[model samples]
Each structure stands twice: as structure tokens, then as C-alpha cells.
Target: MQAKFLKSLMYEAQYKDYSPDFVMYDTLLEKNIPVVEFGSGTGRITLHLLEQGYRVFGIETDEDYQGFFLNKIKEKGFIDNFCYVTDITEVVEICNIIYPFNVLFHLNYQEVEVELNKLYKFRHCWSKLIIETDNIQYINSQSFRSKFNQNQDYFFKEFPRQSKSKIIIYNEVIEKNSLNIVLKFEYSLYLHKADDLNRIYNQIFPSAKLYGDFNLQFYRKNSPKLIAVCIK
Candidate 1:
């Protein structure tokens, strides 16, 4: 990505009410775990990880973006501590087959399964994991899902309408298999208010408690962005 495109990404973040420093570094301060970031676009979070003394590996599919990351790594003289590769499918083969480092993944909602499937074997190897992706709530909403194509001029986006409709249409399978909570966890960001979430959860898992507030560091408050973390 060119610096201009990167800046455009940042500007979008700014428009959402998120500050640069908050999303860039401070959020990871409490944990000094080594990081392997998937879909590491333009080194946004990778640079902050390096500055905090944590070893960082970035996985990117686009060759141009991978080169951008490499150039930044060279300029910063972090050749040893920070590295990036192009293909994530072969990540486990290249690194340890088991737990290598705490994983940090940032991708679209459609790729959540892909990322999870890739790291399923490696999950036990790490001490912690963080997944940064779209809010399930937003994707499920008619307005938000439509906004993707509308905002981008509907060029070539693959909206995961099946995933959204699956949970609703197959509620019997969901309740019988205890998949309701998982669905809520994934889509909690779509709730406009805390009460809205509370009501939805009560309707689904009545006894479930709201664990915490949304961490808006990686997103602007009003924007449709959401970052969910699952630590095992």
C-alpha cells in the first residue's frame, strides 16, 4: 500500500473517533507476549508491537503490502525481531507446528473461519490470542452490510450473507447445539446500546452476563469496526 492509501486508512480511523496512539501501542502494553499478526496490512500494528520489545511476525498475502512491511522493517533496523511473509496458509509449516507465538489476526468477517481453521492446531501453542475483525452485529444488520457495497461502490466485495442468515434461520440447530452464545459473542458489536445487547442476550442466553465494554481503540466509536479478543 502506498503511504497515501495507508494515510487514508488512518483517516478513516480518525473519522470514527479513534486516536492513533490508542490503537497503535497502548492497548498491548499489559501483555508482553510475542506476536504473529495475520493480515498484517501496512505494518499498522506491527510497528507498535516492535517498539514495545515484543518479537513480531507479520503475515500478509499481497506481495506489494509485504514489500511495504519489509521496507519499514529495514528502515527501522528491526531485521531480527520483526519479520513478515506473504503466504499465511503455510505459516505453520514454516514455523513450529505447535504453539509458536501469541497470535494477532486482523481480517474481514468472511475470513474469520479461514484464520481460525489455519490456527486451530497452533492455538494450544500460544499463551494468548487476539482476533481483530468485523463485528458480527454490524454484518448482521441490513444497514451496515449494505453500507459495505454502497461505500465501496460495490466493486467486488463478498458479503457473508449466508453466515448472517444461517444463525437466524437455523435457530433450532443453534439452541440444540449451544451455538447461541458463540453467535452473540461474534455479533455483539451490532448492538447499538448496552441495553440492546442485554435484551438480545436475554432473549438468547438469559443468564449470560455482559463481560465488558467494547474496546474501541482499533475503531472509531461511531464506525462499524469492532475488535474481538479470545484468550485461551
Candidate 2:
């Protein structure tokens, strides 16, 4: 009903056809060990795994997305396999953790260090940790005539602001038909190079592997997405 929520929904819809990030981990995510998805907004990856019969626990704190995620879990016609996990300690199982999409980008490089350190304590409980985020070096190299992009419902603009520590994105969502600005917000992202992230992950986990994209190619400059797999 709200413009921001509507814009967010439309943004997610655009990724519906992109299945590589959502499906690539299927075999690694064992059915016996629980699957934990951080930032499981609107039940995209959560529902996909559930449909495949893998029990999933979603960790999210946003109330708006939480409401939608809960409703979607009910729509799946069963609640036994999916969990809206409020506390990480609540899940007491050896698990495969998914920290996908914009989840990591929301934290700055220092914050990433802190978070990964916290996750490191759960090394025994987690079998693996997968993180997907934007490649700041690649994105910064591009020259865009417009910072704006759109989906079916609304047109939005992302202004990337860089400071000593983080790359923050300031967003503006406008009404579709009227073209009137409807919502404005901003969030921070870690835009450091692959080696920076790899080092941090390696310090926390035994092995850390990074890919440029979902195809699992070795990470290189200009790669659009940075995907990291840390093995316990």
C-alpha cells in the first residue's frame, strides 16, 4: 500500500527471472542440516528452498518484509518447514548459511569484520557461509548517464555516496504515472575489493573462495557481483 513497499516489491519482481543466485546452492544446502537465510525479504529464496523440500530458517528484522514473508509462508500451505528466526541462537543445528544479495552491502567494511567475527563463533554449528554483494570497484568504474532505474510500478534513482569507510546509496522512488517523488531513503554498503573481503572471511573461516558471478568464475576486476563461499 505504501510507495516504498510497492517500490521494494517491484524491485524484487525484476529478480524473479534470475535464478542462478537462488538455485546454485541447492546441493550444498543439505535437507538434514537446517538452512539459514539472512535478509530473507518477501520469501524469495526462502520459498524456493522450501518448495524443494529443504527446511529453511529465515533471519530478518524488518517489520514490513517480515509481514510479507509470514504471509507468504502461510500461502505455501504449510508452516512446518519454514522458520522466521528472530535469534540466531534459536537455531541449534549444524547449518548452511546464506547471506545473500544486499545483505552484506548494508554493512560497511569494519562492520563486516565485526559481523563475520560474530559468525565465526558459530563455526561448529554452520557447515558453510555464502555471501553475495555488489562489486564496488566494478560499479564505480562505469559511467552512467542516469543514476535512475525502474520497474513496472515506480522509477527510482540511486546516488552512490562514498566516504572513508562506506559506499552509501541514497534512493528516491517516484510515483509511476504522476512521476512525483514518493519516498526517499539511504543505506550503506561495503564496496571494498575482493581481496579485502577474502582476507576477512579467511581469518574467520578455514577457507574462503570468491567468484565474480553465480557461474563461480574466479573474481576479477569489473566483475558485476562478488560471491564468497567460506567453508568450515
What is the clash count for each candidate, in the order shown?
A: 4, 0
**lDDT tens digits, residue span 1-232, model 1:** 3332332232233233433434523553335555766655566666666776767767755554566667777889876987665444434432321111112222233343444555554545554444332333343356335212111211112222343324211111112233242111121122233233334334433433222223444334343433333344
In lDDT terms, which candidate is top?
A: 2
| Model 2 stretches astray by more than 4 angstroms | 1-4, 134-153, 177-179, 210-212, 217-226
lDDT of 2 at 127: 81
Indicate the residue-level lDDT of 109 in model 1.
31
lDDT of each: 0.41, 0.73
Superposition error at 104 for model 1 (Å) = 11
Full-model lDDT, candidate 1: 0.41
